[model samples]
Structure formats: structure tokens, C-alpha cells
Target: MNSTVTMIVRLLLAIILLVFGANKFFNFIPMEAPPEGSFMDALIKTGYMMPLIAVSEIIPGFLLLINKWKGLALVWLAPISINIVLFHIAFDISTIAPAALVFTLNTFLIYINWKKFRTLF
Candidate 1:
């Protein structure tokens, strides 16, 4: 990838993650509640799960912003992105657009970092 493009994408994704993840804790970005009986509603009802999930988002978002251990940060965010995609697909179709964006960014990052990952497989 072009270095400039890489940096732009990295910064955009990092900013997005940082804002959303921080919102999870701060509730600064008001969002509608997930539908009743939906998976998200159930998860939210659990009390403990949301905080952990929020932390997971914050950590990777911070790492990505710093451009440190970005590959590892993307690796950490992978499952979270997948879950976001799946959850939106299954429960809230209206939200899949952002989830798709998240998935795509993570995928693109991983592709560009293929050299770093080649030995893992």
C-alpha cells in the first residue's frame, strides 16, 4: 500500500475506533437501545460483558492511534469486528453498514501486513 494511503486509513480507523470505544464508556454518543430480545439487548443485560467489550475496543483503538504494535492491534480487533458484523447481520440489519466498514478496514490492514503474518501460518 502507498504509505500515504496507509497512514490515512490507519488514522481514520484509529479515530473511529477511539471515538466509538470511548463512547462505550462515556456514553457521549447517544445511541438507541438494541431491540428487545435481541442479542445485543441480552448482552447488555449481562452487566459485566459490556465493560469488557468496551475495554477491548479502547485498547486496540489506542494502539492503532499510536502506530505501535498495529498488526497486533488489528489482530486483537479482528474478532471484535467479526462479532460486530455478525451481530448486526443477525439482529440489527440497519447497523451492518458501519460493521461492514469496520470489517473492511480490518481486512485491508491485515492484507497490507501480510508479510508480518506470513510466518504465523
Candidate 2:
């Protein structure tokens, strides 16, 4: 990938993750109500689940923003991104754009950093 494109994508994804991750903790961003009795509703009801995910997103997001351990950050983000897309797809297709963005950005980052992860395979 072109260095400029990679940098742009990285920054875009980092900002997205950091903002949303922080929102999970701070309520700085208002969210729409989850569908009744949906998986998202269950996660919110569990109390810890949302914060847990916040930390999960925040850490890797911070790492990505700082350009540190980017490969590891991308790896950590993969599952979260996948679940985000999956949940949006299953419960709320209308809200799928952000989730898809997260998944696509993580995938692109991983593709660019494949050499770092090749040893794991």
C-alpha cells in the first residue's frame, strides 16, 4: 500500500476506535437504544461488558494512534471488529456502516502488516 494511504487509514481507524471506545466509558456520545431483548441490550444489562469492550477498543486504538506495536494492535482489533460487523449485520443493518468501516480498516491494516504476523501461522 502507498505510505500516504496507509497513514491516512491508520489515523482514521485510530480516531474512530478511540472516540467510540471512550464514548463507551464517558457517555460523551449519545447512543440509540438497543433493540429490545437484543444481544446489545444483554451486553448493556451485564454492566461490565460495555466497559470491558471499551478497554479492549481503547488499548489497541491507542497503540495504533501512537504507531506502536501496530501489528499487535491490528491483531487485537480483528476479533472486536468482526463481532462489531456481525452484531450490526444481525440486529441492525441500518447501523452497519461504522462496524463495516472498523472491520475493513482492521483488515487492510493487517494486510499491510502481514509480514509481522507471518510467524504466527
Candidate 3:
């Protein structure tokens, strides 16, 4: 892929992730109570812990958007993607589509920037 396209993709990914992450912190998206006995319900049952999860989402999202911490942002992306994918898989497969797309795009972004992450080896 062209470098310009790669950069654009990265920027878009960063924007989307950052906005969504901020939503978790800001509750720009209203929270609905999970259904009784649902996996989400179980998660909510953990109480204050829920906000911590939201923080995890928000922080990485912010990092990605800044673009200065691309490597750290990518590191954070893995767990966030896994959580989103699993949440959809276990709770609501229908909603998984967007998460899947994000995951796919993030994977591509990571691959395109793999050189920056090479120091981890």
C-alpha cells in the first residue's frame, strides 16, 4: 500500500478509536443496563470496575489519536480489540461487525507500522 494511504488509514483509525474511547470516559454514549443474567450484566455486577475498563479504552484511544505514541497505542490496541471482540462474541454477535472492521483495520495499521514496533523484539 502507498505510504500516503497507510498514513491516512492510521489517522482514521486513531480518530475513530480516540473518539470512541473518549465516549467511554465522557459517557457521550449513554449506558444501558445489561440484561439480566447477561454477560454484560456480569460485567456491570463488578461495579466501579466498569469505569476502569472504560479508562483502559479511553487512554489508548487518546494515545492513538495523538499519533506520537503509535507504538504504545498499538500495544494497547491488542487487548482492547480482544475485549471488544469477545464482548460481542459472548454477548451480541450482531454488534461485532463494527468491532471486526476496527480490528481488521487496526491489524493493517499495525502491520504497516511494524518497523516502529520492532524494538520490542
Candidate 4:
């Protein structure tokens, strides 16, 4: 991707992360809950899980916005993104679009920053 496009994608994803993360605490944006007895229901049942997810989103979102340790930020978000996608895929087919977008963005970022990760492997 061109630098401008990459920056746009990064910003878009970062803003989404920050907004959703903060929303978890502030409820600024209404979030839909999964139906009862689903996999995500189990996660939501753990009160701390939401806070923890908020931190995860906020930290990596900030990292991406500041253009610092971006590869690490993507790494941090990978599992969270994966889980988000899987949760939607398994429990809520109706609202899988956003989760799919998030996962796609996360993957694109990881691929774009692969050079920084070469040393890890």
C-alpha cells in the first residue's frame, strides 16, 4: 500500500479501536450484546473481561496512532481481532461485518509491517 493509504487505514482502525474501547466504559456508543448462551455470552459474564478488552484496544490503538511500535501493536491486537471475528462468526452471524472488517484491517496491517517482524521468526 502507498504510504498515504496505509496511514489512512491505520488511522481508521485506530479511531475505531479507541472509540469502541472507551465506549465500553462510557457507553457513548450503544453496543449490542450477543444472545444468551453463546460463546461471547460467557466472555461477557466475566465482568473484568470488558475492562481488559478496553485496555487492549486503547493501548494498541494509541500505539498505531502515534506510529510507535506498530508491529507490536498489531501483534497485541491480532488475538483480540481473531477472537472478535470468531465470536461473531460462531455466535452472531447477523453482525459479523464489523468484526470481519476489524480482522481484515488487522491482517492488512500485520502484512504491511511484516519486515519489522522478520526477526521474530
Best by lDDT: 2
- Between prediction 2 and prediction 3, the one with superior TM-score is 2
Residues 1-121, model 1: lDDT tens digits = 6989988888878888888887878899889987899777888899978888888888898898899999899999999999999988887788698889888988899899989988878
Candidate topping TM-score: 2
Query: After superposing candidate 4, which stretches have Cα over 4 Å from the reference?
Result: 32-41
For each candidate, the alpha-carbon lDDT, in order, equals 0.87, 0.93, 0.76, 0.89
List per-candidate RMSD values in Å: 1.2, 1.1, 2.2, 1.7
Clashes of 2: 0
For model 2, how does the per-residue alpha-carbon lDDT over 1-121 read when each residue is reduced to its tens digit?
7999999999999999999999998899888888889888999999999999999999999999999999889989999999999988887899899999999999999999889989989
List clash counts for every candidate, in order: 0, 0, 0, 0
Estimate TM-scores for all models. 0.93, 0.94, 0.80, 0.89
Candidate 4, residues 1-121, lDDT tens digits: the string is 7999899999989998999899988998876776898766777798899889999999999999999989889999999999998877786779888888889999998888888888878
- Report model 2's TM-score to 2 decimal places: 0.94
Q: Rank the candidates by TM-score, best first.
A: 2, 1, 4, 3
- Residue 8 lDDT in candidate 4: 92
